[model samples]
Target: MLGTICRFWRDQRGIALILVTIMLPAIIGFALLAIDMSRANNLHNDVQKGADAFAIAAAAELDGAPDAWTRAERAMENLVDNTTRFSNSGLVTLASAGSVTVNPGASSCRSRGNISWCFLKSLPASDSSPITSSNYATTQAETLFVQVTVTPESFSSIFPASFLGGSNGLTVGATAVAGSPGAVVCDMVPVFICNPFPGQSLYEVANSGQFYKKSLKLVVGSTSWGPGNFGFLRPSDGHGYGETDLATDIAIGRVPECVSARRIYTQTGNLTTKVKAAFNTRFDIYANGGGFPSKSDPRWPPAPNVRKGFQYASNGNGQGSGSQNPCNMELATDATRYHQLTRDTSFTGQIGNGGWDYTGYAAANQMTSALTHFGSSYNNTTNPPSRYDLYHWENTHDSNGNVVPVGDPNSLVHTQSVGGETGVPACASTVGDEDRRLIYAAVVDCSDSYVQSQLNGQSGAPPAIGFASLFLTEAVTGDEVMAEIVDIAGSRGRGTMENFVRDDVQLYR
Candidate 1:
């Protein structure tokens, strides 16, 4: 028996079973540890997704409104409903700080839900770094970004705690930061006007009817412009853009550069003659000479509606003989039927009151009934809708394109014509960027000492107070841009100007 036992011990046959028995526990333990690690990784991924979704939702509502933070919090709580799987709990819904005050420096957190977050006007260096007082946003306008932190999810691992000499529970967490990308505006017009109402905030002035229907005569000069005065903007490249370049940009909408919403640089020079000549192209009036595009060129097509009060000579008025250029004849004074609009009485300098010649203009255009459509809002003598308002009304209110006294068979559909040319475009068959008559210009508060100091030769960028949508009332004469402020950039009263703004949001971390 001893000899047989010694032979068996020396033998390798069936010895593998003993080795397997000894290593089986350790192998199973490693397998369980791997399963636990996989579960933790999956939980982390889910938590990260939840954080990202919540942050994006919150960032979308930071549109400079008064209750932006409150709205952001509400959006985060109500919008996202992420549930995590692969945890010990089987399925766990992500927690949120449901009801918490948004204190500036301190994070808004809730222990019950176990979520923490904060608003930031700017960004931090790293996603893991804590938000501090210097970077936190206190007001709605400053609340441009949001940071979200999900509470750690604890789950028991399948592995035995005593085997690994550690706790069986594993924890996973995630964080995300989202906000609006820097306000980069593309295809912006290279013109800026001083804020007309410096006394009131941009929101207040936009909402108030005081700016509506008001006429502004924008002039070009190297001198310092006050409120209502207008000037040229330097492209972001900082090149010395001359009149030729300015004319091309104004006429064809060939933008020089994209600009930042926070600030803009100014161009110094008197771009009067070229500016006027180029601006008139929108009115279907190309100059016979002076390098202006001919009427036949489709690239510089006129607006669909060009009803400036003036007559032109078919023979290029001694310029390009027999060329039929519309810019041949100078626009007649208001005394003549072919007249430019007179300024409003309420404002001084370049800014006009809402009081424009609505009655006389309507009568001349045979749209008197359009004014009556306002019904009690039309005073006939006072408080009449501006020509810009009437222009849009005429465009949409008439489907068949009839003018005034709609149902009447005698009322002419082709009633809007002045100086032998109809309101309808005659230059080109197709028009591009149909808002040709509309100019989206930056409104800067040049009255500010800092802004004033930056004018003329200075290189400093002056902040734009707001963007104003001005309608070209008539063909530009000399250096003056005869326009009416129809709408401005803001939440209060955004009309057609909303089309120009290109705000986008993205994840910072």
Candidate 2:
């Protein structure tokens, strides 16, 4: 028996089988761990991608929408709850198993969600802060910054805990920060006008719902600064710009940043030629269409009514009422019939009862006629197309004695018949018409001190309170260029910071 035992102990025939049995569980455990690790990595990458997408989407609405924060949260939730992947060769569903946090003007990451997963929380404020990335630290009220964090719940590993030190659960997270650094407007007109309404920003005016009711007459040649005064802008050197360069700038939509930064002054010279060129460029009037004469048309010149400038009598007669007057006589010809068709009407039902002078009423009437003609010619489907509606008047009483404005639900201006006729004609859509004007004049704050600063170039360029789109109401004369305030472009209380006409969204961290 002893001899048999010794021989068996020495035998190595089945020793290989024992070794295989001992190492098999450890090998299987390692393979399972690798598979779990791969799954965790994939989940990490997917969550990171979701966070990035959500942050960017949220950043876009920060300026325009009232419910920007809510919208952003929803976007993140949607992505996390919908993504799915495979685990252990079997499909595993992924949900919003983590919390999401939002910090609008966050200086540093702090506890925001239930899960201790804050975005950039460990980063010191000095080294990594949202303000550092955002150039406008002073305008924090208008600027918006966002942070998002995604932490998935622990996922069960396929590896058996008994073999591998109970490493059965895996959790991963990702974070991102996005910001909207305010707006930089391109294609702005060089002219600046003092804000007529003091102590109230354009945003305040818009919010008060009174913007549409106010009829402001901007005088182009006036030197006295007041609520309704306007003037042509000159370069820093006080010299007038070339007409061609000015027109080209309007067409291309922006002046050089360096030039725009310099102070602008009221033009001293007669601006008749420059005004006509600018107006023609905006309306494409020199180009052909709408029963109007093209630049190529030979019959264009004898009829001064066909020109885009202020429609004044060449003989120096303001109203041109006399039969011999060129303005009054030009309307008789067929080529000038469009001009005749646009004459203002009165409540007595008499046509041509109104004078075509430079008065505010004349300007308003001229604008209406031009818009109507343009709409009839260019717009195929809509009558009095929205682009032509430039006037917004105060509220009017209804037939039932209740207050009502035309297009009440969407009306921006109140319209009432004054002296048996409406001062401003109604356009199909006021919102659409507001953006039609090609010339935009900046509204500067005209408060006593601010005005002085602007005049002396001490305050740099005067802070633009708002912008007004100009609609030529009358043809250009020697020194007189008449236009109506068709639309106002600006926000209330948007001081110092550039207006948010356009926005750019991006990831800061």
* Clash count, one per candidate: 0, 9
- Whole-model Cα lDDT of every candidate shown, in order: 0.68, 0.42
Q: lDDT of candidate 1 vs native? A: 0.68
TM-score, every prediction? 0.72, 0.46
Candidate 2 deviation (Cα RMSD): 13.1
List where candidate 1 sits over 4 angstroms from the true fold: 1-46, 57-148, 151-153, 293-297, 313-325, 334-336, 339-345, 369-377, 396-421, 425-433
Put down candidate 2 lDDT per residue, 349-407, tens digits, no spaces: 11112222223332333343333322234321222222223232211222233444543
lDDT of 2 at 92: 38
Model 2 stretches with alpha carbons more than 4 Å out? 1-38, 61-144, 150-171, 181-185, 192-216, 219-253, 256-387, 390-437, 441-469, 476-502
lDDT of 2 at 123: 26
TM-score of 1: 0.72
